[model samples]
Target: MKQKAWAIHFIYAGIFLLLAGGQMYAVESFQLTPSATKFLAHNVGPGPDTPRGALNHLMVNSGADVRETIRPPGWIAWAALSAGAVMAAHGGLLIARKK
Candidate 1:
């Protein structure tokens, strides 16, 4: 009975970690485009040079042209991969113990 309880606990923990890590990874990887810039420009009053501008000045060309991009650090991918691996290992151990 105790072993079964432990197995269930490990399984649940593994699933939760895997899902949370995946969500973090997805959020970090998502990127915005020029269309988003146009939408922001239309909805928002400020231009790219403004303090509240959505696009960075370095990437923006003049006040009318704005380009936005997102690039996640390699560490984020590594962390996600590590979390997934840990989850797989935990599940594998749980299954092995049952045998």
Candidate 2:
């Protein structure tokens, strides 16, 4: 009886994790739009002014490219999602056995 209960809980948690993990991965890509101008300015560095100039310099002129800052990476989210799926499977088996 207890194991069956656990299995149901695992399935629920797994579904939640899958949704949350996908959202997290998506948000990272969205950041580029909001930060575009600022990214160019900083990346181009001190010297020639203006956002347009900076953009042209960064993309068109392209003398020295700047490296983007790194994030903690999405592997953790992937891991969470994978674990959740396993838990759900195990839980499902338990639930099935109860019948």
Candidate 3:
């Protein structure tokens, strides 16, 4: 029973890792700038679409203003990669341990 639950951890880790990996690959392979991130954050609204005139919201709190000349923050990719690694390691430990 517990082992089965541990297997589910692999699925969760794989999902997150795949998502972040895909994003990083897209950004690197396509040379995407911060503008793309801004567009997704503002229009696509990964968090929320409607603000309802609120001063502070998920979209508002997402990212810093991206200048046209500068590329997007590198930390975004690193953070995503780090998170995926941590999740993968956690899932791996859960699956490999006998106890």
Candidate 4:
């Protein structure tokens, strides 16, 4: 019973991850909200030399609309999708084995 429950949880989690991964994969880039931008600026600090720091500074300090853009690498999506598929498959196998 416990094993079956775990299997179900895994299946659900895998499906959610797969969906999120697909969404991330589909969207090439996304804009950061003002709050998110400010948060990043605080964390990233005010250094102007590095590209990330420059962007962060601009978004935080500039009065003009300076939305930060996030471009997730291709590997992350592929990895998430692969992991979700593997997890779902493993869960299915576990459930089958228990029966």
- TM-scores of the models, in the given order? 0.41, 0.50, 0.42, 0.76
Ranked by TM-score, the better of candidates 2 and 3 is: 2
- Which of 2 and 4 is ahead in TM-score? 4
Residue pairs of candidate 2 with colliding backbone atoms: 7-91
What lDDT does the true structure give each of the candidates? 0.64, 0.65, 0.60, 0.84
TM-score of 3: 0.42
Clashing pairs in 1: none
Candidate 2 lDDT by residue in tens digits, 5-74: 7788889998888776777666564334325534555565554477756555565346443434435467
Candidate ordering by lDDT (highest first) = 4, 2, 1, 3
Candidate number with greatest lDDT: 4
Indicate whether candidate 1 or candidate 3 has the larger lDDT. 1
Per-residue CA lDDT of model 4 for 1-99, tens digit only, reads 999999998998889879879988999998998777777777766667889788667657876665678999988888889889988998999999998
Candidate 1 lDDT over residue span 34-98, tens digit each? 77855555565466567666344434434555655556776775676677667667766877878
lDDT of 3 by residue, 39-77 (tens): 555555444534642322443455755423324466777
Native RMSD of candidate 2 (Å): 10.1
Query: Which ranges of candidate 2 are over 4 A from the true structure?
Result: 29-72
RMSD from true fold, candidate 4: 3.0
For model 1, state the Cα shift of residue 89 in Å: 3.6
RMSD of each: 7.8, 10.1, 9.1, 3.0
> What is the clash tally of candidate 1?
0
